[model samples]
Target: MTAAPPSATDVLIVGAGIAGASLAAALAPWRRVMLIEAEDVPGYHATGRSAAFWHETYGGARVQPLSMASFDTLACPAPEFSERGFLFPRTALTIGHRSEAGAVDGFTAQFQARGVEVVRMGAADVAAKIPGVRAEWSEAAFEAACSDIDVGALHAAYLRAAKRAGAHVATGTPLQSARRMGDGWDVQVGGQAIRAALIVNAAGAWADRVAAACGVAPVGIQPYRRTVIQLRLGVPVPAQLPLVIHIGGEFYFKGESEGRVWLSPHDETAVDPHDAAPEEIDVAVAIDRLQTVVDWPIAAVERKWAGLRSFAPDRIPVFGADRHESGFIWCAGQGGVGIQTAPAIAALLSAQLGATLPGGAIGAVDPMPFAPSRFA
Candidate 1:
């Protein structure tokens, strides 16, 4: 006969991306938590394919709190992750053609009213930023605070801190099934059965499927595919070049390092949940738009890839416990704002569940917008 299986844990996280990793780190001090990832290494999905920016004004109004809440974490980070002055001096600028002037003005006014760091820039200013950008293309524009985020360092810091606090981080353990057990949940993963008092659905692009598997109602989370391409710029490029975004959101480009630049079309087509790949048409579109912005010859194609940014119908993240499912919590629908808001999100939900957490910072972020029961 075989010995009894391991006992249940206090919490089980279903994804090992920024959200799940940060939560495990925040909650490990006082409870037993197990973070499960299907991949051989963590962040093998959306987190790995991010364009690596820390643009604050990118997400919608409801998502503002999370970015604001993440300020301290990104600014004065711990030694496990050192600030590389990575953000640089890039201002996030949105430009519009004549047809998009109204939308551009609306966007500027809306964010300006919210006290977001945004101000209108004339077409000449836009020309200075993107030298070859068509002047007629700038009917309206605005600049705001933005930075390029170091995705690797951010993810590693979360995992390190979480592990240090005794949380178990297991990769390659795909969750097979989950069911409510006596006062908790019995989760089967990688042919092993384990029990947990609470389950966190931080599965990113696979979040909806995770919900269906665990007998929770799906909240109609949609994953959108976005592609990015890296180019080597042999010519000297200014370090302060603001990230240029089309007011119509047709394309975006920003400096990566001394002689490298990254470009994307800002495309958001709905896609199936899977390992996303770059489509030829998407790459063509991005290159066409990028040529409009800069005259620099693409010396060499460094790399290209794509990732899924999962969003709820309202395009804001879902947090808190399910209204019907007693112990099911949600940390999904982070969309493109995952890395920027990881710190605040962890604190917010950890406090919502009354789990022990770091910094006592949860109260700083109002939990109303991110409640998981919003769909119900």
Candidate 2:
């Protein structure tokens, strides 16, 4: 599954998921870039499986900036980068049981303090928005600015932009090993060997594994499985149903076209890096939890899938050049917010790689907190 890989490059990015693809697009104008993917196609794993949304509060405060910074681009990208915007108007609601009112209040206040447009919803407001929810599930907050991301278009645009900027992508080429030489690293992918001045670890769930393959110290990147299932509901649903979330992080569901809904248990089971699949127990739990919140009958589960959400030890994004190994960059550990934060993170990394720091919130984002030096 190896494409004809280059013999040498200024930069070699392992794992051609959103992280690598976005960064490749950002840096390609200034550097010779090549991206290698283990799968026959790019974004076949986590990136492809993501039910992503550009919600500001989804990743908590520390990650909010990247999501916020990337909004303008995701909402409206340059004409050369994308044919259209990737964000669609789909707001979010963080609901809690009556007993969890304080939790909902705190959640709303936290984001409201950050200048997010949010409204504290009363019981009636909650019931009106999500028709079948239980009376006990009254405490809620609404984020009008939350939007659903067009992940496919966003990712494909980055890949196209990168290729247009002279970046080479070799699909089905996995990094087998790498060794640091005098001025460059010798990387072996399958039977092909290439020399690169710098190697970017954007391998998603395989981030730590890639670092080990290069004899670089691992940053404790761990993968967790999140399951999402599609259901054919027994009741008529609103066409513009907002994304309903549990403030305590137990479950989330949103309406789809027709009588369908996408639901998740919000379970994060720590697992090894591999192709993830939905567990039946998790699916059952999801249905049970949703039942507790709403009377909507689930006629049948039409489809189910799972994906990995990788995170570093601190549960924050890891970016910038490695602390001890500047030639190696860590662009993994974005957890679930990687898609929303890609534009900012990619720009930050490009800045570290010699590109000018971009203006706006991306420039205000301090890369130090996300730097790999914390792990060192």
Candidate with the greatest lDDT versus the true structure: 2
- The lDDT per prediction is 0.80, 0.92
How well does candidate 1 score on lDDT at residue 375? 80
Compose the digit string of candidate 1's lDDT tens values, residues 267-374: 898998999999989988988887766677778778899999999888899988887896998899998898888878998788766675455344566788788777
Residue-by-residue lDDT tens digits, candidate 2, 292-335: 99999889999999999999999999998888889999999999
Model 2 pairs in collision: none
lDDT of 2 at 227: 99
